[model samples]
Structure formats: structure tokens, C-alpha cells
Target chain A: MKTKNMISIWFFVGCLLALYGALILAAGLQTYSNRRSANIAMQNLHLQGWWGTGLLVIGLFYVIRFRPRRLR
Target chain B: MTSIFSAMLARTWAPTSLIAAASRVMSLGGIDLTIITLYFFLVLGLGLYLKKFTSTGEDFFMAGREMTAWIAGLSFISANLGSLEMMGYAAATYQYGILVGHAYWIGAIPAILFLALVMLPFYYICQTHSVPGYLQLRYGEATRSLSAISFAIMTILMSGINMYAMAVIMKVILGWNIHFSIWVSSLTVAFYVMAGGLLSAIFNEVLQFMLIWLGALVIPVAGLIETGGWAGMVRRISENFPGQDFTHMWRTLGSFTGNPMGVHWTGIVFGWGLAISFGYWTTDFLVVQRVMAAKDLRSAEMGTIIGGLFKMLVPLIVILPGLLALAVLPFKLVPETMANVPGVHTYNEALPLMLARYCGPGLLGLGVTALIAGFMSGMAGNVSAFATVWTYDIYKPLIRKQASDQHYLSMGRWCSLLGVVVSIGTAYLVMNFSSIIVYAQVVFVFFIVPMFGTVVLGMMWKRTTPAAGFWGLLAGILASFVLWLCVKLDPSALRLVAFSSHAKDMAENVYRAWWSLLANVVVTIVVTLFTKPKPEEELKGLVYGLTTLPSLGQLPIFKRPIFWAGAVAIAFVLLNVLFW
Candidate 1:
């Protein structure tokens, strides 16, 4: 059961990573076609800023909500 | 004329040189004037006030270990952020790309999360005053002794690197000589750290944190705006690099071969975040002091996590500016040419220099003030940690047994004074030796790796014997030294260079430092597994019990999504890593 749980978790993570990678690959291609510089990529990242903040807030909530049963 | 010449000669040898140089430098308009004035008085005031706090060893040394998580978290950030992060990351980012973000993705997030989740619980359970004390509990007195000595030496070397780095920045930015800059910075930092201990250190960091943000963040924001907003920056970046892979975080400009001396992604992620972070979060007195001082275990744990979250935004401030600088300024005639231009020597000075020249006065002054503030924050943290190590780790156990709290606190104050003097002396050595960032890395690789091995394994495995602990630690140190020798003599390692003409010489030294950490970890694990396990009595409170978990203690459950969130975060980071 534990092995199954662990494997499922890994699978879910693998898929998410694959998705993120795909998006970046697409972005990279677009950047290349458009002849983007490193700063442009960073600026684009800034322009699309709140993604990380949302992820973080979600992550924080998840960690807090699922805290260990015996915790003070 | 003859009499006037004699008088001038006498004045040259007089102590007034520092005062004269300091005042003349302070006379500069806008940014510099603000820095000099703020630096001069703030540091002096901190030192005098510390006189009151210095009455006992406990008070002087640990601030009686009564600090909050926020203070501890801030000081930890300040200590690590230093000029290196300010200057080095910015320069690196300017030259490289979002690839530098790999540092956050691979090293920082996981490492800090692991520190909080995996290690902190055990420290609270062990309930020791310091990492060394925890060592004594898990490994025995001999391992504790060895661990303490190594930690102290590393801290001194690190303080030296930090002090020198800040001095260099001040000199370059303000057009002061290295010698004059060193004394001015060292004296002021020493004063408040001597007076306040952790209290002053923490207080200064809250202020310093703001400065670091300004110097690092404000520059990038303004640079982006000046260059024509976010879209304009993107437009500019695409225009220059031409058909480049900018979106992927790991694969960016100049990252692939820029650091041929071997600080690649593996090193930054695994070596820096995993190996180095474990040692720092678990063992380093700077962070541990805060955890020990926390109002409760949960608060301590939460504060560290808060700090980690704050660290997530750091690269945005520090590294991005560096990348921006590289784009904004044309590829110069080497680092020295850029450095000699009064704004570009070290990573810390890069942003301020850019802002001063490019941005208007008010903004430039604010940026310069941030750098000074960052320097002061770093210095304050170093002094506080030195005082703690001296008082708790060294003085109380070795020097006196029946000393009063007041007496111990007083001893702590005196210790802070001595710490400042020693640190200043050490900083002078760093000034003559290497850049602060490189020096800090060398110290990290050689000194920290072995300590990490003992502390991590000792906490996890109940069967880890003191005999194993001592031998593992000894072997790790010996192994790293031997590794250092191999890298030092290697021909390929000798081929690299830094910004100086003496780059080849310094590169060889750094290569030795880098490779040694890999050797230390390998030898430590091998020695540990082969040796005997710790006795049950020694292991009792040290390792986690199957039953008594800190997070699970008496808390009612919400339909907690935290578990699912943790799972998702893992997914997100992996996706970022694999895809980007």
C-alpha cells in the first residue's frame, strides 16, 4: 500500500514536471523565433509575476492543513 | 616651507589619517554622504548600547536564548545574504539568465523545506542549547569537542571573508582605499555587536533586510522601467541574444561553461542546497540561536519556514539585477576594467554603481543606503554568532563553572569586543587574499561538509555510536584535506582564472576547496555505516521516536490540504526543473 502510494505520488509529480517542461519548451521556441534575450525572458517572467505567488500560497495552505496529527 | 613639510610628514603618520580620509570621503554628494553619515553613527551607537547588555555571559553571549523566530530568520538571511549574494548573484545573473533560478528551484526550496521539516523537529526534541551540545548528546563528548572546534574556525574564516567583502565594496563605490574602508566598516560593526549581542544583531537585520531589498530589487525594477518597462526589457533581451533559449530556467546564457572551475548546477543544487544547507540549518549557531530562543517549538519551526519563503524571492532581487547589468552594460574589457570604473568590482557594488550612474540622485542614494544597510546587517550577525560561540561553546564550559548569569553576560560582552578585534584582523587577511564570494565558498566546502555528515546521521540513526561519530568526523576532515591536495595539484584545475591578473593562482586554490566537499561526504558515510551504532541511552532523545512527533502533538485536525499541497509543490518544482 505504501509503495503504491509513493509511486502514485511520483507519477503525479512526473506528469506535472512534463507539463511545465512542455510549456517552457513552447516558450523557448517562441522566444527563439522572436529572438529573445535572457533579460527578455526574465522580464516576461516578471510580467507573468503572480504565478509563483499563487503556487506558494497554495503550497503553504496544503502544508498547514495536512500537518501531522500529533503536532502541538 | 621646510617647517610645513616636516609638519605634513608627521601628520601622515598620525592616527588622523583614518578620520581625515573618512571625512573627505563623506563629503561626496547624495548617495555617499548618506551612507557615510548613517554608517558612522549607527554603528557607534550600537556598540555603546551593547555595554549595558554585556554584564553576564548568558546575557552577552546568547541574549539568554530568548529571541523570536522572526529575528532568528532575519539574522540568518542577513548573514548568508552578505555582499556576496548582493554582488555575486547580480553579476552572475547579468551574465547568465533565468538558469540562475536553478539555485532556488534545486537548492534553496528543497533544502530549506528539508531543514524545517526533517531536521528542526529533532533539534527541539533533543532540547540542547546549541548544535555542539546536541552533538555531545548523540555522539558523546569527544565528537562534541571536535565539532565545536571546527565550527569556531569556520565561523572566524567566514566572518573574515564577509568583513573584507563589505570593505572592498565601500572602497570601490565611494573611492576610498581598501585600508581606510576596512577600519571604518569593522570598527562600527564591532561596536553595536559588542553592545547588543543577538538583540542588536536581530534589530540591525530587520533594518538591513530593507536595505538589501532596495539595493537588489529596486535596481532591477528601475532598470526595467528605464529600459522601457517589462515589455521593453523583453524586447531588448530578444534583440541582443538572437534565437536564444531564454524561457528554460536551467539553460540560459553563459551558464553552461562560464564557471569552468566546476560550480555547476550539481554543485549549486546538491552541494549548496542539500549538503551545505543541511549543515547550516542544522548546525550553524547563527540560525540555531534563533530557534533556541523561540517562544515555542512551533514558532521556531514556522519562523524558519517564513525565512525560507522570503529567500524564495531573493534571486529576483539579487541575481536578476546582475543579469540586467550584463545586458545593460556592453561586454567590457574584462571584470577589472568594469571594476576600476568605480562601480563594478564585486557583485555587491554592481547594482549601486549602475543606479548611481543611470538613475537620478534620490533613487541612487536609496540604493546606496541599502548596500550599506546590507553590510551593517551582515556584520552585526557575525559579531552576535561569535559572541554566542565564544560564551556558550567555549567560555562557560572551559573557563568557569560557578559564574553568575550577570557575570556570564558580562563575559559575553567582553567576548563580543574581542570577537570584533579578531574579525577585523581576519578581514585584513581576506583583503590581501581573495574576493569575498570565492573565499566564502572555499570555507564552505572544506570546513562545513564533515560537520554536516555527523549531525545528520547522528540525529537519524539511533545506532550511530560515538565511536562511529568521532571516526566519521575525523575521516571526513582528513578526506577533504586529501581531496583538497589532489585538486590543488591538478593541471586542469590550474587552467581557470578570475577577474584579477592573479586569477590562475586563485583559481587553483578555489578548485581545491570545491572538490574537497565531495570527498568529505563520501568518506563520512562509508566510515559511519562500518562503525558501531550508538547506545540506546545516548540515542533516546536525539533521534525521532516512532510515536512522539512534534507536528502531531495535541493538535485538532482541519480537513488539512497541507499534505496534498506538499505533494503538489513537489510536482511543481520537478516540473520547473524538468521542463524549464
Candidate 2:
């Protein structure tokens, strides 16, 4: 595949992951507010919000900064 | 932890931890849900995106022969690393102890290396799209058709096992609706496989491999740290499960009477390592299709070697979790938790229980998603293999000998969905069998054992006739089922049987495969003596001695396939000795 198409695919992957991450983080907010709904292990771990943020960062980096150098 | 999921022909079943776990996760909104949903979206995106790049039969079925060694090698093993494997190996190790590592080490390493060094040249040179396609050239249309039909059925049945395991386990643990889980898995697999075909399937498998490794890594790391390391973990297992051989891989293999696996060295070495392993690694179309998609012959061969190296480490990920669970996880659930879950008596819940103890929420989501990915990878692998065999080997030859490449390409897509639809029936069908993984292996034995004998004779001997191949394969299949049924009729009949039998599931599997292979070889030879063989000129490019293979002699030491093979073999010996 050409570099341009490769970049576009990765770009799209990045966007999708980042979008889902945000939604996950938002759900965690509501979950945290309702103490009855939240499980202690999950609440103690704080899984949703942080992993979502991590996904956004990873995806954004691939979308904006990553590039491969051509071989000699 | 789920049920033992084993179908012993003894009909012993165990309950899983699915119901209790699922209720708890549902209360927490099932963190697995969020991660899994995103994962599904990403997979569909990839399949749809790759669809544009896949237009012809070659591209859809074989990735247009453009994959690198890295891609091919990872995809090769990934296709085999489904949830059934991850959970099954762990559960087996929990029950059988460290002897289960043989499945990865001696069982896999040699066969993979042999495929790289010996078999790739013929397959690549002949350029058959399917393993059955090779049979057509070496044997005849009857042999190929039998193979194609049996293999097509095998793939769908195997996928059905995966689907059933995922749905059943999810329902019992996470309290998800079973039909919903099945539909989600089936539709997602069908969508991608129908859209991108094999390339999409291969690409997702590689992705799943990465996720599986990342997801599973935490369990061992956390368990070891908590237990204070490998030595500590071993010490605990010995203390908890007293008088059990929990750590040694080969130390107790002097006889079938004592080892945890209950198999003597003959069964371990000849039956498992030689017969079953070689049959699976060398000839099965599900995995071989991935290798055939490589960019070139060198890459294809190199890819298998690389895969072998990775395979040597797989036991550490899958089996070690079971050992860890044995050392630390609770054998019985607390009463409060038991209220939501059914009771069982076994170590089959080792992996998931350990996962729950080790991973919190985020990591839990990732870990569970890894398992889900494994389920889909297995389903996708079977679906894609079924499509290739159906479209290329069965449909094209028998139904329409003269169709456009486009027509076949369309047929391949439709067949991918058709295969998944058939798998739904099979998924329900396999539920009647007790254990998902064991039943799957039993299915493989009927096809692979006898099929291996036919392929080996056809490829190595010029005198092997097509009639010999057909009759040999048929006889072998018949013998396997008959032997199994005899054992089924009387479970105690195993001791009266030959080839080493301690009556355990794993050992029983080894002996059956050995018997099948022996029958296949003897029947083929006996039949060949009475029949006329194929002509010498017709055997060119198919038989070993007749075909002039591209020599690897000129390649540097580091680049040669033999060098890698030697390196892997030495490592194999070291592992056996170290574990011993």
C-alpha cells in the first residue's frame, strides 16, 4: 500500500478509537456518581476514564505525528 | 472460571463461573461492554477498508501474495490462538499440570520447522490455493473432493465450537443474553470475512495476537509478583495441591501410570509430537492458508520459522496462568457469590478467576476483549478457510468449471457468509458435545491423522496411486471413529486398548490419533500394491525427489532455513531438560 493510504487508514482508526474513548470516560462519570451501580473493584481501579484518555492520546499521536522513513 | 467444557465421551460436565461474574459485571455496566463495543467498530472499519483492496480471488483468498514474513508468521499462529485455546490450555494445565507444555514445545516446534525447511518449496512452487488443491495434483479429483468436503465441514464445525464457547461462557459469567452474544459474534465475523475475505481475516488475527499478548501478560506478571516469583508460585502449588507433579514437563514421563497427563513417552513423543502435531502444523488448511499468503517463497518459509520461535513462548502465556491459578485462586466460591453461580468441582476456572483477581477494571476490559478477539479470530479463520475450500476446490470444480475470476470472487464472499450461517447450526450442534476444545481436537483427528498419511505418501513416494490415497484416507477415518466408539461403548475398554492409554482425555486423544495414522499408512500401502501408480512425468513439481527444489545452500548462515531449524531444535532440547 502507498504511504498516503496507509496514513489515512491509521488516521481513521485513530479517530474512531478516540471517539469511543471519550464516550467511555463520560459513562464512567455517571457510573461514579451512582454509588449503587458501581462495583468497588472497578471504582477502585478507575478503568474507564483513564484508559479512554490513554486511547485518545495514542490515537492522536498516530494521526498527527507518526511517519516512517524511506530505506536507502 | 467457566465449565470444564470437556466432552469426555464419558459425558462429564462442570459448571462455569459465568453467571456470578456476569451479574457483577452487569451491575458495573460490564466494563467489557465498552471496550468490546469499540473493538467491534474497529474490526468492522478494517474489514470495510480492506474491501476496496480485495477485488480478485487471489487478493481475497491469499492476500494477493504480498504479505511480509512478519505479517505471515504472526497471522499463522494467531489464527490458532482462539479463546478456546487460551482457556482450554489453561484449564488443562490446571488439571494436568506442566506436562501440557508439550503441546507447545515438542509438539509444535519441530513440525513448524519441518514445514519451513521441507514442505514450503512444493506448496509455493505448485501454487495451490488450498491444501485440497494440492491433493488434486498429487492424488486425484476424488481425493481432493473428499478432502475439500470434509475440510469444509470441519472448519464450520470448529467455528461453531468457538461461537458456542463465547456465547455460553459470556452468558454464564457476565449474564449476557446467549442469543445476542452468538448473533453479535456471528454477524461481526460474517461482515468482515465477507467484506475483506482472507486478507482481512489475516490482518485481524495479527491484531488479535497483539491484543492477546498484551491482555494476558498482566496475569503472569501480577501473579508472580504477588507470589514472589516463579519459584514462589511453584512452591505454593506444591504446598496447596500436595503430591502433585505441578512443575515438571517431562520428569514423570517414564510411564502412563504416574504422569499428570497419564501418557507414556511413546504417546507423548510419537503420538502427540510426531502424529498429531505434525498433522496439524504441516497440513491443516486453516493455518497453511495464512502461510501461503506470504510475499514470496523465502518469506513463507521464514515466516513458519519465526512462528515456531514465537510458539515456543506461548505456553508461558497460556499455561502459566493455569499454574498461577492453582497456586492462589480459591477452589470454592464464597456462599454469597455462589448464590448467583452454579457449583462445580475442577480447576477449569483457572484462567478467568485469575483474570478477575489480577486485573481491575480497565485492564479487565482489555483482557476480556483479548479473549473475545480470540473467539472472533477462531471464527474468522474457520469461515475464511471454509470459503476458500468451498469456492476454489468444491464449487469451481464441480459446479462451474468455467466462471470468471469476478464470479468466483463473488462466490467467495457469499460463501463466507454462508459458512458463518452453517456455523450457527454447528454452534448449536457442538453444544451437545461437552468440552469445546476437546471436541474440536477430536474433529481434527478424524481428518488430519489419516489425511497426513495420504499427503506424506503422495508427496514423498512416486508409486502412491490415487486409489490408494482415497481408500487409505477412508479407512483411516473409519478406524478412528470405530476405535472411539468402542471406547465409548465401554469406557473401561481403554485399558484393554493398545498404544498406551491411561483413560484421561488428553492421553486418549493421542492414542486414537496414533491408531488412525497407523491404519491410514497400512491401508494405503496395502491398497497401493494392488493398484497401478501414477506416471513419473505427472509427479513432477509434486513429489519430493522428482521436483527440483530451489536450494537454500547459497544463503548466509543467518538467512538459511536449516540454521533456524537447528537453533529451534536446540532450544527445544534445552527446554525439555530445563523443565525436567
Candidate 3:
């Protein structure tokens, strides 16, 4: 029962991540036209640049990796 | 007439004895100014009307958890928005650029989403009166007690600064002494809030938010037009601060000291938005109270998101004004302009200054009233939340377990009055702090982030033991305080030890302190994961409803979408960093 519950919670988290990913992708595509220039230096980018992209992918994976385990 | 106006301004604006003398004479017949008096009556009337809702403990304290989504959303915004955010946003926008504006967009929206999609489910399942009530069910007596105490302390400290911010404005505008302004501001709100409990608070807050929105937004629009349109305003600013990038959305991240108003980067933008939004949406009682007062879990969830939508429109009211102020004043005239205004100083006073100067007499009075409304509503919110925790979490359980519901309801009001006095007194006592905006931002970073561990773990991970929750909360807080001490001690501590310190360096960048928050959450979660899970019986009440019978249904599409919409909104807002 506990295992089943854990699976359910993870499944919910996964859904949130997937939704987060989709939104990021949509935002990226939507704003791509408006974004004419990316002026960041490499060092700055290394520190925090891919934040949007990174968060999106992580969110997507969280949803994808989530699965409901069968109740013990 | 010009002499009278200047004399009046001088009386309020002048240093020392002359200012006080002028304040006394000017205030002789100004006791009941039209706009301020009308607002005072309005607050009193609302409390009287809400008296019907104050019959029961639940009714008075939580509005019977039945507020509509719109009211909940508006009241939530009003309660927490306060003078702190209003003034801070204006100052930041004046000095920096739209990067600070992203705070509302990224943080507020995502926070609402988390509350709607994530936090709501747990609240619905647990069905506790207060969020800490949920803690009691999830952890135990000690955890609940500690959380309640910590929350009360935090609310007092935070509210104390908020009171100071409001009192400073009133002190300047009315030419009242600091002590008089503090009492007048504190007592007016306290009286109404004491009458109706949370119901009165919610009632007045709806009106308060309307005034706050109008005063903050309309002043900027009028100022922009007065300074010539957006193009004119921009042209004027560029000419003075030549070649300074005033268009970048993420400029702070580009250079550590990069021209914040120009060029681009996302470090501070992302940092502030992420920290404030998450903390506010999930942890802060002032915001969480509105969610707790929802008629049902869905209402609570949806109400928070609706508030996020309102937040998205805030920059139009707040951030734009600073740019307008900058454009209107000549570069050399900036200091003189500030000096000329009797009650305006710092970033918080910019909006007030714009209104007092540009707005006509009737509208100027209205604007002043709006500022007062914003402040009183914030005070009422703190008092109400403090009282709720005190009555429900402390007094009922510890002081009088057998007390009647009516007694508890009455106790709530007394608690609110006590909270009001303590907050006002604390504000007067702590006059030597940094700027209100920085002070508010700093407090939230240190105090709130550590709680993310307990809240997130409590909701998601059943393997989180009670012991883990207790120890995690304690350790996380300890870690943050230690970090705070380290920053103060690193150079100063050595200096003190050697008796060689003359001038101290500015403390570490706020961004560095924010990293401590992240560390606290990690430590709490990692510790929780390693501890033995709670026994199933103890966990069942929190993990699932205690109905003893099961009647399950499908999840709503909007519930999920509503949550996603928040995340989507935040992402779009972050994309603004590109314009940086």
C-alpha cells in the first residue's frame, strides 16, 4: 500500500515536470522571433544562462520518469 | 498662495523645531481631511457589516473558509502587497529596469501554480483549519508548536518593518512626529480588524486592493503623459544617463555591477523571483491565510492562481512610475526634487512624490488615502494571521483545551490587538536598519527558504519521519542563522577581536546569502530521505482523508491546466531576460 502511494505521488510530480517542459518549449518557440540577440559572455552563461532550458528538460524528465508502483 | 504652499511644505519639510511648529499649526484644522476621513469610515463600516461572520471561531478567524475566488485573490494581494513591495518596486524600477519587474511575473505565477497544483491537494486531504494545523496532523505536537511560534515571530518582525515603512510616509506627509504617526497608523487598522477578525480583514482588504491598484497604477500613467508619452520619457532619460542601457530585462546578470537599467543578464532577476515567489506562495502566512480561508480545496487552489494573474499586471502600476519619475526630473534636479518634497525619501516615496506634485488637489488627497489604505490593510493582515495562529495553534491547545468556541473566537480579536501594539512598538524600536526594501528582501531569504524542506517533504515524501521534519526544520533554520552570522563576523569579527576595525565593508551580496537557502532545503530533504518513514496509521490522516470510506473521482483538467498556466506564465516572463 505504501509503495502504491509513493508511486502515485511520484506520478503527480512527473505530470508537473512534463507540464513544465511543454510550457518552456512553447515559451522558447514563441519568444524565439523576438529574441534577435543573445549578448551573454561564456563565463556568465556557464554560471546561469541555460536556466530556462535546463528547468524545462528537468521538468519533462520528472514527468516521464514518474510511474505508479503496484501496491505491495 | 505660493508663499502659503511653500510655507506649508517648509513646515513639513524643514529640519527640527520649525518643522514641528509648522506641523502643529498646519494640522490644527486638518484633523479630518476629507479623503482620509472617508476611508476611516469605510473601514469601520466594513467591520460592522462583517460582524455577522464573526459569530463562530471558524467564521471570524477563517471567514468560515468560504471566501469566493475573486475576493480571496484580491484580499490575498492586498494583505501581502503592503507599502514594502509598492515602494520597493517603484525605487527598483526607477534605478534598475524591468528586470526587477520579472519578480512578479516569474515568482508570483509559479508560486500560485504550486499552490494550486501541488499544495492544494495536501490541504484538501488533511482538512486542517490552519496550515500549521496540517503540520500537527502530519508531524506531532512539538513540530506544530515550533512552527506556530516561528511563524508568529516572523510575522511580527516582518510586519514591524512594514509599519515603519508606512509610518515614515505618514510622518513626512502629515508632518507628524514618528511616534504619533506610528500610533495613528497602527490603531486605525487595529480597531476595525479587532471588530471582525479575518472577516473584517477580508472585507476591508477588497477595498484596500482597489485603492492600492488605482493609486499605484493611475499615478504612473498620468505621470508618463505629463512627461510626454513613452517615447518622450525614454528620450529624456537617455539624454541624461547617456549610453546607459535602460532597455535590458536581465542586465544585472551581464556584469556583476553592470548598468542595471541597461544591457542584459538574469542572475538577480531569477534569484529574487525564484526565492520570493516560492517563499511567498508556499510559506508566508500572510499569503497562505487567503488560501486557507477558501471554502474548499479547489477554491483555495484557484484563488491563489487568480492572484498571480493580478500580479502580472502590477508592473504597469508600480515599475513604470520610477521611469516616469526619472524622465520628469532633470538629472541635476533629482536630489533637489527629493529634497523639495516634505515627506518623500528613498524608493518607497517616489510614487507618493509623483502623486503629491502632479495630481490635482482632490486626486492628491485620494492618492494619500490610497497609501493609507494600502498600509492599514497590510497591518490588518499581519494581526489577523498572528491572532489565528495564536488562538488555534497555541491558546486553544496549550492555554485552555476545554474553552468554548465563542471564547476562542473572542481570544482571536484580543490576540490581533496585542499583535498590532507589539508590531507598532517594534517598528519604532528598530529604526536603524537598512532600507525597508532591502530589509524585507533579506528577512524573507533567511527565514522562509528553510521551511521549503518541511513543507515539500511533508506533502510529497511519506518516508519523511516526524523526527526528520522536526530536526530538519531546526537544522535548516540554524544553518541560515549561522550563515548570517558568518557574513557579519568574517571581517568584523576579526576586527572586533583585534580592536582594529574602523570602516566595515558592505556585507556579502544578497545572491550569496540566497545560496544558503538552497543548502538548507537540500540538507532537510536529504536528512528526511534517510530517516525511517512514519507509521502508516500516523501518516494516513495526512496522506489520505480520514473519511474511513473511499469515493474517488477523476481529477479536473482545469486543476492541472490552471497549475500549468502559472508555470507557463513564469516561463514567458523569464524569456523577457532575452530582451536584456
Candidate 4:
């Protein structure tokens, strides 16, 4: 009998983070253009873009490393 | 009136305290909604996909015992990292200052290490499906039935409480309707848990742990930067509170009057650190079920140790935000009583208020999603545990004893669905009488301390007879329940239970656990002296002297469970001293 390979939980985590990172990055760009925010502190830092980029990079690494593979 | 209108329009732009007084703290924008929607789809989809793997009773209830140490470890800690706990501890820190940190450190770390080192061997070696299953193996059917019924009731009600808490938080923070929040989140959890069982719950727990950190880490980071770092934050707190010792963990704990919590060091060390912490960390099936899924005994031990390591770091995300709120927020936060009055914020709002202070649209959504993940994961943990206990310990033993593996598997899945439905009903019931939450806590206190005593004595002493185990547990539980009633009927009775009139409600709980544990120990020991012992052959693998623990002599010293546990112990000590 041929056994099926299970999808890694990390891969799912990576996908979620990657997608969220992209959306947040786009929102950050929009925030930069609007020059308005509800946040009280560190508004000039544009934390959304920086944090989003970090998540995207880390997420892509996990995706590449743990993506599901065909069982031999 | 103009300011209130502006606060309503601008949402988070206004001061958190002011906005909380007038309306919801923050509104979810399109980006935030997208993030949350994506989360639901991902969890549900994963659950459906994993359904094929869960064809057997083992797979449904125990994740087929195939998880690696890392997976099991993350899932172990995450099961306990529910949003209710997150918010409650944070609120505690806000109310009692850093004294609450004792719960994370001394109150938890020693017990977790003890579980990995002392208890996991018996549990893993015996191959019991649930905690009550272990009880049945050691004590008999009577003990198992009592434990299973109480635990089953507790888990379902606790799941309901989590659902209600999530809905209330959503209503307070985002102005979502309570019914909409409860039903939608509960249904999503029910579907996933029913579809994939423990495996699905484990996967979501791991994801929720990550999300909780990602969402909450921003608060301390931003707060530190704004205050110039920890020293600066401490300075600001001292400046703000004047004579208060909010920054010290142990210094003010020497006297109940000296601390905001009205708890002395003895209660911190003996009551919380010894009794309550051990009772929960070592015995609670909700977290233990996660570790039981490990691929091997070594993995189980390693997973628990790893969980302890991670657990030490949780304060950064949960407690720091509360501490930061004391220093950073411009206004005082009233208790729950005055929370509804305009211009007054409650201690519970510390985390959300901090999120509002730092996170704009995109990040705000991530933070909200993390909280939602926490609530769902909590529900999933409880429901999954309930299903396992109900099917294996209750239904199989009591209802039908001769069912096939397939039948049990089907029952597990159906129980998952039934548990969620009951939890939803419980959530609505709590909406009418909120005191159910307090009753739930009282019930937890009654069971956990005594159960811990029964299990530990049964595992450590070969002479502990089944009758002693059952009667000892009953004595402890009855003593605790009576003590609790005494305190409730006459508030002055707290002085006797807690050994001081200044002891607060928090202290009362801790001291109650200690007294109950003492009652159990005394009764168990006396009964054991008179009762006949089980034969050595029957006691093998379950008791300390009869069982031969696996040796790690061949493994590298650094890779040994003992080595890592020691390292964690040292770190735990350092943290207590650093914050002292």
C-alpha cells in the first residue's frame, strides 16, 4: 500500500504569515502615502512595512524549507 | 459631547481611556477583517484536509502518537495560552503589578520540570489514553468515574466560558455583536475539532502560539522604545505611582500590606508555587493530552521540558504589556465595577489599550486575529479533551464496554460535536448569570489539588491502596468545598483559611489549594498505612520503586532531558532574582 505524505504545519504557518505580510505591507504603503494614523507612538517608523517585510522573509524561508513533498 | 463624537469618528486616534469610556476601543478596518477571514479559512481547510489521517481511535483522540518533540512541546504550552488566560494574567499584572509574575515563574516552572522529570515516565509507560484512564489503572473504576465526570463537566463549561469571554471581548474592543461572535467562532472551532480531532487542535494551537507572539510582541517593543527601555519604564512607573512598589516582584511580597495583591511570600511560594501550580501543570489533562501525543517517551519528556522553557518567556508578551500600561497610560484604570462609566477604563483593557496605542490598521488586525486564535484554540483544547475523556473514560467504560475501534472513533467525533453544542448552551447560560465563571473556578480548585495528591501518591508509593486513593481525594475535595463555602458565607473566615486578615481573594485561592493538598496528603498517608498494598507485579511501571526509568547514559550530556531541565531551572531562578 502506498502511504500519503502529510502537509507540514510549518508550511501552513508560512503561507498564512506570507499572505498576511503582503497585505500588511500594502497597507503600510498606503499609510505612508496618506500620512495619517491612529497609533499614538512611533508613527514615523512605519512599523507595518518593516515588521511585514520581516515576517514575509521568515515565512518564505519556512515555506521553502517545510513544503510538502511526495512520498517515495 | 464634541470630544465623544470625535472619539467615535476617529476610533483609536483618541486616548484609549477616553475612547473606551464612550464606545468600543477600536474599529476593525478592511485590512484587519481580511486578516481575520483568512485565518478562519486556513484553520477550517486544514481540519478538513487532516480528516483522512484520523481513521482510528488513536488518531482521533491521541493524534496517533506521532508528533515530534517540537510539535508536541509548542502544542503543550499553547493549549494553556488561551486568550482568557492571556487577558486575565495581563489584567492581573495591571491590578497587582509584577507580583503576578510569580505565577509564570516559581508557580509554574518547577511543576513543569517535575512533570517532565518525575511523572511523564509513568504516564508514557502505562499507555493510558487519558488522566482518568491512568487513575483507573492505579486506583480502580470508582476513582476513574468520579474524575472523568468532573473533568468532563469542567472542560465543557470552561469551553463555554472561553466562548463567552471571546464574544464579550469582541463586543468591547470591536463592537461586534456577542451572539454573532459566540456562534461563529464556536462553530468554526466545532467543525475543525470534529473533522480532525487532536491533530487538528494541535496544529491550530501551534499556529495560535506563533500568532499570539507576533500580535502581542509589538506592545512591549513599542512601549520600551517610547519609554527608552526597561530601566526607563521602571523609572516612569515609580514617577507615576510615587510610593508604590509596582516594579518589584519579591520585595513587596514580604508583607501582605506592602503589596497591592495583599499576598505574602509564603502564599506565593507554598500556595501558588507548590500546590496550585503543581495541581494544574502536572495533572490537568487539557495540557497533558498534548504531550501524550509525542512519538516516543523521550519526545514526551523533551516536549514538556521545552514547554517549560517557552513558558518562562510568555511574560514578555502577556505581563509586560500590563506593566507598561501602568507607566504609559495617561489615566487610571478602574476595576470592573466602574468600567462602564464614561472616562473610566478597566484593568482588563490593558492589552487591547496597548494594541490601540501602537498598532494601526494592518497590525491592529493581526493583534485581533491573535486574540481570536487564542479563544478558538482554547475552545479546541477543551472540546478535544472532553471528547477524548467522554468517549474513552465515560461512554466506553460506563455506557458500552465492548465497542470496536471504529465505534469508538465515531463516538469521539460525535462527542466533539456534542461538546461544542453543550459549550454554546453554556455560553448563553453564562450570559444570563455571569457568576458561573466564579463557580467554575471553585469547581476547578476542588478537583485539581485533590486529584494531584491522588495521582502523585498513587505513582510514588506502592502501598497506596485504591480505597485510600478514592477516599483521600474525596476528603480533600470535601474539605476544600466546605472551606470555600465558609469563606463565602462569612467573609471573615478568610483570615483562618489564609492565616491572615489582610489576605485578598487571590491569596485565599492559593491558601485553599494548599490546605486541600495537605488534607489529601494526610488522609492518603494514614489510609495507606492501614490498607493492603497491591502486589509488586501489578504495581510495576506505575510506581516509582517498581519501575526502572530509561537511562540517557549513551546520549550527549547537553542533549539529555536532565541537562535541559537543569538549564531551565537555572533560568527560572535568574528571572526571579532579576525581577526581585
Best candidate, TM-score: 4
**Per-residue lDDT of B66 in model 1:** 53
Greater-DockQ candidate between 1 and 2: 2
What is the descending lDDT order?
4, 2, 3, 1
Which structure among the candidates has the greatest DockQ?
4
In angstroms and one decimal each, the interface RMSD of every candidate reads: 17.9, 4.8, 19.9, 2.7
Candidate 1: regions farther than 4 A off: A1-72, B1-32, B39-58, B228-231, B241-247, B252-269, B330-333, B336-349, B399-402, B431-441, B493-532, B551-579
Could you estimate the TM-score for every candidate? 0.73, 0.88, 0.75, 0.96
2 versus 3: better DockQ goes to:
2
Model 3 Cα lDDT, one tens digit per residue, B1-580 = 0000011111112122222221221121131255467567656766765565467888878887777777787887777666546655665566565555666666466666777666766766666767678878887788789888877876776567567655655665556567776787788778878887887787677777766764455466566656577778778778867877565565444553455532223333433455435655677666778777877666666677777677767777777777776777533222212454443344434566566544432344445666777778877887888898888888888789998888998898888889888887668655654244344334445556556657777777677777777777677666655654665558555233212233111113223324545665676667777877677777764663322322234776655435546565765666564454
Please, what are the lDDT tens digits per residue for candidate 4 over residues B166-266? 78788888888888998999899999999999999999899988898898898988889989899999999999889888888899987879998788889
Of 1 and 3, the candidate ranking higher by TM-score: 3
Summarize candidate 3's per-residue lDDT along A1-72 as a digit string, tens digits: 011132222233334334433433343343344552322112212211132245456546655665644556
Model 4 spans with C-alpha error above 4 angstroms: A1-4, B1-22
lDDT tens digits by residue: candidate 1, B1-580:
0000011111111121122222122113443354446545654654565455444454455555555666656655666566544554554444445554554555455656666677777777766767787787787778777777666665666566556655655554566577776677677777677676765666566556645664445567656766776557656666766665433564431333443222344445554456545555556666666555555666566566666666667766865665565456553312332333432233334455455534332233445666666666666666677666666666667777677777767776777677677877777765455444343444444555567677777777665667777777776666655544444466443333212222232233333333444555555566667777665655666786532665556554432223423653565477576645
Query: DockQ values for all predictions?
Result: 0.02, 0.18, 0.01, 0.55
Share of native C-alpha contacts between chains A and B (below 8 angstroms) recovered by candidate 2: 0.06
Model 3 pairs in collision: A14-A63, A17-A59, B245-B262, B249-B580, B250-B264, B250-B265, B264-B580
